[model samples]
Target: FVNGKSLTSTSGSTASQSTFFAPRSKTPNRQAIALISDHGDPAAEIGKEEAGGQNVYVRQVGEALSKLGWQVDMFTRKAKADDPTIVQHNPHCRTIRLSAGPEEFVPRDRLFEYMPQFVEEFHKYQAKHHYPLIHTNYWMSAWVGLEVQKTHNVQLINTYHSLGAVKYQAVPHRPAIAETRLAVEKAILENAHCTVATSPQEADMLRSLVSDLGHIEVIPCGTDISRFYAIPKVDARLQLGLKPTDEVIVYVGRFDPRKGIETLVRAAQLIKRNTVDASNLRLVIVGGSDPTKPDGQERQRIEQLVGELGLAEHTTFAGRVGHDRLPLYYTAADVCVIPSHYEPFGLVAIEAMACGTPVVASDVGGLKFSVVPEETGLLVPPQDETAFAAAIERILSDELWARKLRKRASERVQQNFSWTGVAAQLSDLYRRMLAQSIMGDMILPSQSAISVSLNPDALPNPSR
Candidate 1:
């Protein structure tokens, strides 16, 4: 049984018996970083039909790392038919898109067949311009990262943003993707040089589910505090076509059932009936999916829920809002609500706090780490209708207390999650892996040359 090893699924128990990861001394660090993800930036411009948190995380990390003097190149699959091959994000950060299989959009569940091609393409690019090691995001990219490791003998850091077994158990019926996901995730934990988790909850998860074979660094994600600074309450209301008199609660992310938008709808219903004070309360849902499209089934489900709740007038669906405009929504809202059933790390909470907006988030996953209960924000039991309504009402009724919470929330994020600080930590990880003791079996006893044959079938070195 796969149960005996250090690895377990998201729904599986964290093993009591685990191996500890010993990081070889902090070293010099790598000059260039190869960031890998199946979907997310710098390859795709977000705020489209199917982009969300993962995209935001990768792009910000890349841009932030670049600013700290490391050349960051994000490598990802070209998942769309007309997507560009390369997108230059900043002077130090760039994304190079390459062929994985069919040059078309395929649900990630079926992309396993094309990964060999992905590994080949990565090496081909590496041969052209030397990159020392790689940092892969998500389980799919982790699979490719492991395969490439055999040939490149390069350092790897795997970030399992979300786990499948945990998600599947929550669904009424498990999707076909669930069973296979368990396998790929295990392979990653057992082999990768390290697994970077954004929160301690996720790091604890790695120790319990996967082999504690390597280091699991808990690096919390940061926000653009400068952009989200407290806006004049009156000015913010005008910017979003809102009113000083109206009480608004906002949610931001792609439409997905796992996000528990339906729960928020239900909680909103309860709040409308129960709260005498927030009678003019409005809930706004923002994302990239169009409720009218066939693939946007989740968005349609959410709209249907809104209609069923008879909340047609109390709620506004703002379709998709880009990065440039995200701060406006945060500033205008009375509070930001993150009601995900589970999150590897809650980026939304940090972003909202940076705007000096207090949050009402589900007490699950990284949300617990991002928000402090009754301090910066209130954390309610996930999926509990009454708890959500009460928390919402409490924040709205107590303006003085809410303002104080917002001030502390902004300060906490600035102290811990600045992008520059995160980049330095990552840089240290890269350098430590370069030493002979840390690079695994790559360093031989005597003078040696290591040559990597960029996989078996790939269009090697576009320049070559």
Candidate 2:
């Protein structure tokens, strides 16, 4: 069953095999579409370096779209030699890893040079299995989509997972490829059929920093409600071996400086020093990292800071928690903290909230939209250790208020951030775009033919 609904055969045949395992011919007619995530492999393990929200977003969207009768083909660059070329998530959805530069992991900043080869590989695939509509993720994939559109009649839709214009503002230094990235991001916005912004703040950023000419839509990143939901605190704590009195604060994401891990660490220091009976306070940092990689180095720095701040005894680095086990951590926590310098959308915040845990996130980007300040959770200024400490302390100090926040948080997510709901919105948008393309084609024979058909009434309401 998908989202509490079962699939039934119209013929009412009592077949030996389940309908789920039926051949492609027996399946319903499905629209073929491509989702290109050049650097974010949809099938990659989460919490790893460069494998965070974008990876989860693509994979979840693909599977959810498949349930709505879309044959989803997710494309990504092959970063590892031993990894499979294709990973089938379901009968209708699969991830296609294409070879570009080398069969080794390369940082996103350096991956731009390899996009030409990625585009060529995409062309070869398009020749064999044509996709009339393609949605591209990130600036690199946007470039590929634009290039493919030059040769094919494919309708292009782009999602800027992280815009360089917004990201570069937070960093101390710019990368060598910053100019190229900025240019590509702007070009995609002005050229693609539409650009999807995960938050209204992101859409505003595109208008102010990127370009105002693009058709922008606000569709949020979603979480699997089936996977993440309220679990009894006692049960979750018992499963994770946590003390009943412990005031647990959990941070789940990549170990990057931009993610503001240091701020959370410092906030823990403040919580310990200022609060009475804070001896039972515990900080659980959950994410994957390699010692040699950038994120690993950041982890090392954070660990050293935790030691210097005398938080070593109170802190636990729970390496990498898988999705199956992640909900337990969220449910067990007293409060979840997301101290990112910037987030287009904070997937961790909603995931934790869905598990009936209050969140203390930075008041930046999409966190503003997801976490309803006093109603669901608290939002503090980004990188402000004092503010983060105060916010987290509020949740831990007042059990009744926290409980209220928990219930409202879960309800908010169920009403707005379910993967099934998100996919339905995207399906509507895709159908409308396809219809507009067909309409444009049908009118091409007229003397007063319009090059494009963009009826405002046909567009999905951003307010939804």
Candidate 3:
């Protein structure tokens, strides 16, 4: 339990928890920050049925901020009973999992009801640490930050990983909580000290659809360029037990209706029909959920579509590839497809590009900004099977053109989407907000400002 003590993972795996302290100055300055993501656990494994870009964003940003001298404490719900209550990533960074409801996995759409308990537990933790700065991820966490501001006067900086207004337009059936989400999103944008948009397009969406009252900053999401750097396609394929001569096309993401997996499957069918040697081409769908879950049902739907299109023989559902091994799949692929109906920031596109793979993504939202047409990758209309097929075929058919796109794709990611660079931009914003606080102009609740306590007895020392 995360009552007031740091607990290690049940398995006692060294990789699960980082050391308490790293070598640094005798007495380094401690600038603390609390990152709230109610459902997206920063310490959770990537590529899970529920885990996606938000989890990666939170975890990477926290680690990078720690490097820039901010003591980062990420707050997320404890999903499993046996999971570690706290996961330390560095001397200055840790993930604090607090219980809000049942200590089991819950879908995001139904998690809103547990938020009141989450807010209470979060305040309990804050009563001891008294953090004055909070950077929240997603709308659910944004609501928690809004509540905290009512009583704590903490500076609120938010990143709406997905906007409710924009998202509802993409799906056929909106969740019952759509109204609540839309209201909270607007409130967060208008009231937060600053809202950090992961892409310029997302910032535009905030102004046009959400609200225009609060300050907005465009800070892009990032990838580990070092881990995803160009590796030889032959070597990568060999490591992954893939054929060296096969024309591999990869799709890596959650099995959700909004992801547009059906579009990719249809494109693959078109490619097979239009190509000279269909037997040489392979389509790898790299993620799925347990057969009983909603996402799993979506996976079954995709599998059925693949079968109906006669792609069962040519396609493979590789399931969820581990983070360490994802780069291999990306590097081995001739082209990576991201056929999402909408995306605020397509983290997968940058990641594939970082691995020197050309991307063929839907020309929508942030994908338009991330994928430069005929340069790093090609963008086609969302759900346009013919256009997607053509874009992928162009890259796979011409080796020289594919090589050129691959080189520029890696260069583009290196220049713009490195985690360190993203963190620096965020660190600057955090400092600006703190400066405003010093001037007594920081945003606060309508009621009154609540001062953070300096009492050492409030909470256990986070450094421990």
Instruction: Give the candidate number with the greatest TM-score.
Output: 2
Per residue, candidate 3 scores C-alpha lDDT tens digits across 342-386 of 999989999999999999999988888889999999999999999
The window of 10 residues in a row where model 1 has the poorest summed lDDT is 13-22
Quote model 1's TM-score: 0.85
Q: Which prediction has more favorable TM-score, 1 or 2?
A: 2
Point out where model 1 deviates above 4 Å: 1-30, 48-50, 277-279, 291-295, 436-464
Q: What is the Å distance of residue 207 in model 3 from its true position?
A: 1.0
Model 1 agreement with the true structure over 1-464: per-residue lDDT tens digits? 11112232232111211111112147323256689987664556565544666777788788888877667889988876688888889877888898988876667667776777888898887665455568898888887787776555456778887887567667787766666677667666656666788899887776676544555667777676666567777887888888888888998876777787888888889888886765578898987774464338988888888998888889998878876788888878888888888988878888888888899999988888889888899999888878888888798889999999889888878887776677778766665554432334553332121222223233211112
lDDT ranking from best candidate downward? 2, 3, 1
After the best TM-score superposition of candidate 1, give how far the Cα of residue 140 lies from its true spot, in angstroms: 1.1
Report residue 412 deviation for candidate 3 (angstroms): 0.4
Which candidate achieves the best lDDT against the true structure? 2
lDDT of each: 0.73, 0.86, 0.84
On a 0 to 100 scale, what is the lDDT of residue 189 in model 2? 80
lDDT of 2 at 221: 91
Angstrom error of the Cα, residue 392, model 2: value is 0.8
lDDT of 3: 0.84
TM-score of candidate 3 versus the correct structure, residues matched by position: 0.89
